[model samples]
Target: MEPHAPAGRLAARAHLLAAAGRPEEGLPLLAAASGTTPAQHWAGVPWVADPTLGPRIEPGLLARTVMRLCTAVGDPAPATTVTSLRPYLTVVRHAVDAHGEHAMLLGAGSALARRLGEVRLAVEWAGRGARAQPSKLGEIWLGYAYRSAGRMPEALAALRRAVAYDPDDLSVYADVAATLADLGRLDEALRWTELALERDPDFDCVVHTAHRLRHRADGDVEHLVALADFVRDHPDDAHEHTDLEECCRNAAWLGGLPSGTPLPAGRAPVNAQPSADALHRLQRVSGPAWPHPPGAYDRALGLVLVEPWELLALLAHPETARAEQQDGLEVWACLGLLHHGTDEPWLDSSRRRLLLGLLDGEVDRVTQAALFAMVAYAWVDPEAREDVAAVVAARLTETASGANARAVAELALAAPGLDRPTRELAAATIRVPAAPRQRGRGRSLLRWRRD
Candidate 1:
């Protein structure tokens, strides 16, 4: 080994320690090597001129080593440490720009910014990286930034581009499904999710999002049950636990049960038997206007015809078997039961409860907003409509993202009986500038969310 090989080996070990979640243990080693001269550090390592040599401690590698150490320290490190490390990122950026090597620095910088919650900066760096060297990894980072910033359309566009570049990337497919779901294109989202599953059947992201899309589109509880089972089997996957918890909470709330209700276990059994009447109904309305009036018997029958298991689950009274007295209203709500022609007292009361839950901050903003949008056509009470309109309008004002503001505005417009003042408020809220759209070539790549 060369005289400087010790320093290079030490640096490499430090990087490994940090990567293995023992960043503190790696700090001293990194510090010990800090005083080593670059010449000494690269003494044994071979440069490009020596083609026979295996590897070398090049400037790019050294720069990356420093970055990895800084990153492992995380975002809450001392101010002096952070300040000292900032120049190293600049060094990597300059090296990439000058020599067109070390392109991974862009991704590293973007990841670091994202970790620190500096989404706009992350987008900027990821875009630079992509332009420096277009790769699936860079596109994925850019897509994540776009999604985080609530630029769903652009996010979808970028993720789709990534898929085109690397069709086998399961993560990209999952992202596409998620973005589609956010856009309220549930059918398409489900399709993309199915494709993701085809690629990687056990991918947690795809599975979780698939179940979510199923629930949103058709209120399928079997998906929730499947998720619960998955969580039970894989206690180590934190994301699965989160998904299961969220699904259970939503299910309990919708079922009028305590939020802590134990989740159902195992996969739902499959049975393929449809009544003649159901088949006839499905044939009648399986055309363009399928989602007819919410409370219409035909509509309920139509959903069941399309998804036979839904009707069986409803008939079996799974909630009652699992818990106390079953509230059919919750089931109806889950099935997207809406009051057509005339509003029933039960529908009115349930809608009011959901709306009040939103105002009280008891419900998640996204779920509540979606529910309101779905039932807005039937919400005709002047006072109730005004209350909902006011809340939505206020939410729009408080939201910082153009995408969120647009969502609120769309929800407000969907509401059926909005008075003139409330309507004006919702309309005015849309004009609020959230973030400037990107202009010029590669400009969109670095679009930032402005506060």
Candidate 2:
């Protein structure tokens, strides 16, 4: 075989640095070797010059590789490795044009671009995916990409198209509700949340959506009370940890925090100007989450005063925070507030990586509690539940304290496909409330809509 190209050599060195615990130093190198621009990466490639380039990549091989790469990246991806893989994949993207799962590939590309805060690239991939063929995943991702790009009306239309594709998929309803809430249409959003709940009350997406919307609209302790009601109804379930802990944390702050604060008017997604990097997309999904230098109302919901990552970092390193910043009551209450209620991309990679790293290392009680409360929230997509469940269960065995242990145990039990031993341990440790009998489905849609 020929010796590696200089670009390949540069990429290899970057990966070596990351593997050696010098990830910060490696990031720039990896980004550089990838050429830092689509034009540079795709330049002179036969596939790019002509869609008719001969000898297309074997469809099955390309699809499987792309999917495996997706799973490997996970939340809080191995930063340098992911950065390197991205442009390399883009160069070969058109090579798999004939693949049956080409649409999925494009959707995955859109996701990577979105994570990097490249709004136009994200939307472009989604559009290509949707144009490649009409697919449920394609449409859902396109809707999501549009939402990220601040094209609210188009996002809604695409998401509704997804609903039209499969009304039985409860999560889609929750997505619709979330987008409505983004537009400050709480009533319509709530109706959609209820629509999902009536179909299946246990749905996690709707549950998170309901909590977020209720908290934003009511702007009171009542949202916390509502979460308490759910926790009481299903005590051992880990799915409630984020919501439950948030409620408890907020209840602690109700006395000190001010109320009746005026809120900024909502902006029209349509009127937003385009930028080269699309960093505005980041500001939209969850506003300037770290530092939150503007304080309070700067957050999307205005309920929590501190960024989730900042709270975790402060809790993890109280020695670094000032006396006043240490407790961060409002921060604790609002940790994961913005992202927990939504699906992927909104949660973002940096936050996911930080939370996961904290879970493995030592931290104070407050941080540990925060970690247990929000980990599952980051891993919100039901499709990835198995991986998230494994992560929670492994953490459960290592932790044997009371508060954090119970939270971890309950979270582990709540996950689907958990092993028997993990379930037994979680159940044996505490007395969770008996699950209420499930309500009958097939309720009147007309009544729900009219109400």
Candidate 3:
């Protein structure tokens, strides 16, 4: 039902007045109007009291409410306001749920809670949303929330969904690709990432994914050399350094070393700028900080693939001189240990020590936990892959659990010497036997024989 006409007019004027910089006058009018209803004089105005309110409800309002609450006086009733907008929420929730069975609904709802700084609530809603909608976007958000909230199976399911739904949403391919890397789904992630780049060759997303694809275990070395050549000749474009570093890291991870080419290392890429080679989108989504530094994050990607030399080269470059570089360095060290046998000597040794030394220092808790995971992974003996897997399994149980953590645990079980408990844990993580692993002629490099 529509709100009363007079109330509608007042709400619209209040919204306009607020937008036009006359909130003082507009607020009183809204307050006067709201005073006559069951709703209190929020903003001294009748919110959504307009006749068009039903058709006008959108996620943007949730974002607006979040911004407003952040700037408002003592304790904005965000939860109440959101709940009161039920009619609109119902419409959106129903539509999204109907499309894919409630999977993506959590994403929309979680986004609403996330914007309002309700992180825990955001995670819960995102889980629900993904379970409801089952779309790529839904899975992406669900995985993101699961990772953030410490739920691995849910996170993996979401990420797997994202990969499965690709070529449909190019914008999300980068995230799905990255998640695949973290999960050690290398060949598959590379295939889809390449597809995304093919679809949008000049788009920054493609550039980013291409840089990563060249470092897959089965990556094309010739392309890596060519990309390196591209950077060598295009020295004037300092931004490409990030991409160059990525190429180098990917090569190193895939068992190739970066050419000791002596181009002067450039300055590190800034998080605020839209540089060509950042690993993650630097724009703040709904939190106080972006997930990780793009370059550092890229380095983390390299680590998972066993590329310590590239990480070392990047760390030594002047661009990586900042404190933020430490995060990538730490991950690189950890991944190096896990990818190559830890018994391999002189690889990321110093970086590992540096990270360990900083354990008691001023790093953030989340960062610290991540570092610990890397350290634990590194401590695993390659010959005793099962032993390493056991460590991850124990860590997963001890920790609240997240996507990466769960993935690590699963990888441990798949390790050569996995015991019963670890195997059981891994089994529990997968809700169903994965779809028959698909293979093409080139996919032979990924068969069980290789494993």
Candidate 4:
């Protein structure tokens, strides 16, 4: 009984530190404690009795806390640690049985799995819980896991169940609508989005959904301009920034065609098409600024950064024509290259040039891994292949975080440094849940394709 005392004290301190807005300082201590701690005990679950001690925290609390710390720490090892912990189902089972009041613990597990990029595992745990007991919380989680895994129909079904259980849960409805739109079921998606907005007009997610739908349905330039205006006014909301970015991307994709107007750039010119070299050049232009990119300089100063994926899309946009346009363009190009997956020639002539550009600048481990993954995917051309492989090998040996860590693991498998089983497991980590009928076509867009 007393054995839990020391750990409890440390855990409390960690929690206090995190709560006090000192997450950066609190994270390492949490990680050390997490690594030293054994799997949590589910049996002999005790309720709060000690007046001085307060309520007893669940054994699995460490795992969940460790994950939150990892997010705060912004390191790759924490994600790898969570992935490594996946084999032990008993740990999760114990937590579920012991912490009846802490359903959030189960939600945390599902979220952690998703964060580790283990979409299938995320769905599996969340789905099982939903099946076992159809609580509103469980249903909402099941829907999210399904959405992340690219199973749109299943996600909608789960969301419907969740809404039926509690129609007031605007968050669940917004998520469901988003997934529906991703699957191209725009009409249905719009309806659900409307339902959510009707319930809570100021809901952030609902606002985002309406913004996205307007672009898709009406391609309203005025609406996009308004959204951009709103984002500038509400700079603190990160999601708003994402919405504005998407609006910009949509505008570029529309390529000046009027709203509700037909596609104008329907055909590529004989030589004007996006050549392999042109694509590569466009991607490379994004950058390796010493002070980091213009808008992201402050965020970069903080601990372990995973280069934002949205930056790449911005680079790919035609409207990104400023001198600093390279900041967004290159990142967007990288994302497209990533979309090519690890087994194709998507990188080809264009990708190599872009990678070279990135190398020439001050790219970090995460960006390097992203470039390496693209090279691995475009595994053709002996000279380029060697260059990319060298980059990957070097990068893998050093530190990594976020998607880069996963990319590094994949590189090891492709190059022969990592063992077969570990490599397969890593690949499995990103494998999404079984695709539902509606989302089958969009599967490639959602998951992190190989290489």
**Candidate number with greatest TM-score:** 2
- lDDT per residue for candidate 1 within 16-81, as digits (tens), equals 765675544444355345434222322122221132211223444544564554445443344434
lDDT (C-alpha) at residue 97 in model 4: 56
Model with the higher lDDT, candidate 1 or 2: 2
Residues 174-225, candidate 3: write the lDDT tens digits: 6666656666777766776687777766445545555656545643333443
Candidate 3, position 137, lDDT: 69
Query: Residue 322, candidate 1: how far off, in angstroms?
Result: 31
TM-score-superior candidate, 2 or 3: 2
Assess every candidate by TM-score: 0.39, 0.42, 0.31, 0.42
Q: Sum up the clashes in candidate 4.
A: 11
Q: What is the C-alpha local distance difference test score of each model?
A: 0.48, 0.50, 0.42, 0.46
Ranking by lDDT: 2, 1, 4, 3
| Most lDDT-accurate candidate | 2
- Those runs of model 1 whose alpha carbons end farther than 4 Å from true positions after fitting are 1-101, 234-241, 248-451
Model 2: residues with Cα > 4 Å off, grouped in runs: 1-85, 88-101, 228-451
Worst 10 residues of 1 by lDDT: 442-451
lDDT of 2 by residue, 1-451 (tens): 1233355555567667656755434433444444432223322322223343211434444444444444435422445444445543453345445452467667766665665466797788789888888877788989988988999988988999999989998888988998988887889999999888998887766776788678778543335444544544565653323443443332212212212221111111121222312222222323112221112223324323334434333333333333444333323333444343344453355445544544544323333333433433322333444555566677777764433355455445434445677767766654653233222221111110101
Worst 10 residues of 3 by lDDT: 442-451
Q: Of models 1 and 3, which has the larger TM-score?
A: 1
**Alpha-carbon shift of residue 430 in model 1 (angstroms):** 33
Residue lDDT tens for model 4, 168-274: 87877777787778888889888987877787766776777777777677644334434444544556763432554554432312111112211111111121223
